[model samples]
Target: MFKHLLPRLRERSIAAKRPVSLADMMEEFWREPFASLAPVFRDGGYPAVDVSETEGVVTVRAELPGLEPADVSISVENDALILRGEKKFEGEEKKDDYHRIERAYGSFSRLIPLPGKVKEAEAKARFDKGVLTVTLPRDAAEAARNIPIEGA
Candidate 1:
């Protein structure tokens, strides 16, 4: 989606040796069928994620509609949470029999960085109702420390 477009836009801007304007966008994908498909090309990809933090835990939820728990893989590396998975559709007939193909089916990997630090060892994850939730407990030393205020 928008995530995939930003990098291409930045690269195009760099290669053009100037800033990208609205007119530039029009001219870049300027063609007969290509021009018509300009918008689709810019917006196409996987689901989005929501992250929240409580006093002791950081939770990550990713939208993965139409997928089973086994279809996705989650891991942690350094300060980043890694998600790897594929969205696939199969039929008893064949792949070419489809009349229309709108849904994206392929492998994707997304790395989300933690807000601060967490105890990866104690992290837990669960997938249910097409939502993947990961709860990461804040590292003991990295947890917020409250300081007492004194009257001067």
Candidate 2:
């Protein structure tokens, strides 16, 4: 989706001090739409996630239905938050009877890039119901600040 790469293109444009044309953006989209997303989609994007920031804390929430807290592992590595887990659901078995199972099962790992540096040691995680929430306090020095314009 173009929306997913808009921010990246904008950042690149700013860094290069040049405007990114629509054609350029489209070229990038066409070149590799699935370059980074192939793995995620291939695995069904399990445990769908939502990342948000509030005040000085960055929160990552993931939907992990049918998974127990013990079955999941959370870690921050290589400037990314890594979530790894397995989902296992066994179908009922009756003597000499075949049953069709229509549920997803297997292992999955999701890597989410951090917007800025975070206090990894101070991070906290909570799992309630079928959701997993991780809160990481932003490193003050790495937090975003507005730049003042010099000319009118």
lDDT of each: 0.80, 0.85
The true-versus-predicted C-alpha distance at residue 112 of model 2, in Å, is 1.0
TM-scores of all candidate predictions against the true structure? 0.63, 0.64
Best by TM-score: 2
* Candidate 1, lDDT over the whole model: 0.80
Tens-place lDDT per residue, model 2, 98-122, is: 5655577989898988888999999
Candidate 2 weakest ten by summed lDDT: 92-101
Assess candidate 2 and give its TM-score to the true structure.
0.64
lDDT of 2: 0.85
Give one digit per residue, the lDDT tens place, for model 1 in 1-152: 66667778778887988648654465555634376665675454245888899888999999998888889988888888888998886544655576877777788888888887888889998989999999999887976678999999
As a whole number from 0 to 100, the lDDT of residue 46 in candidate 2 is 66
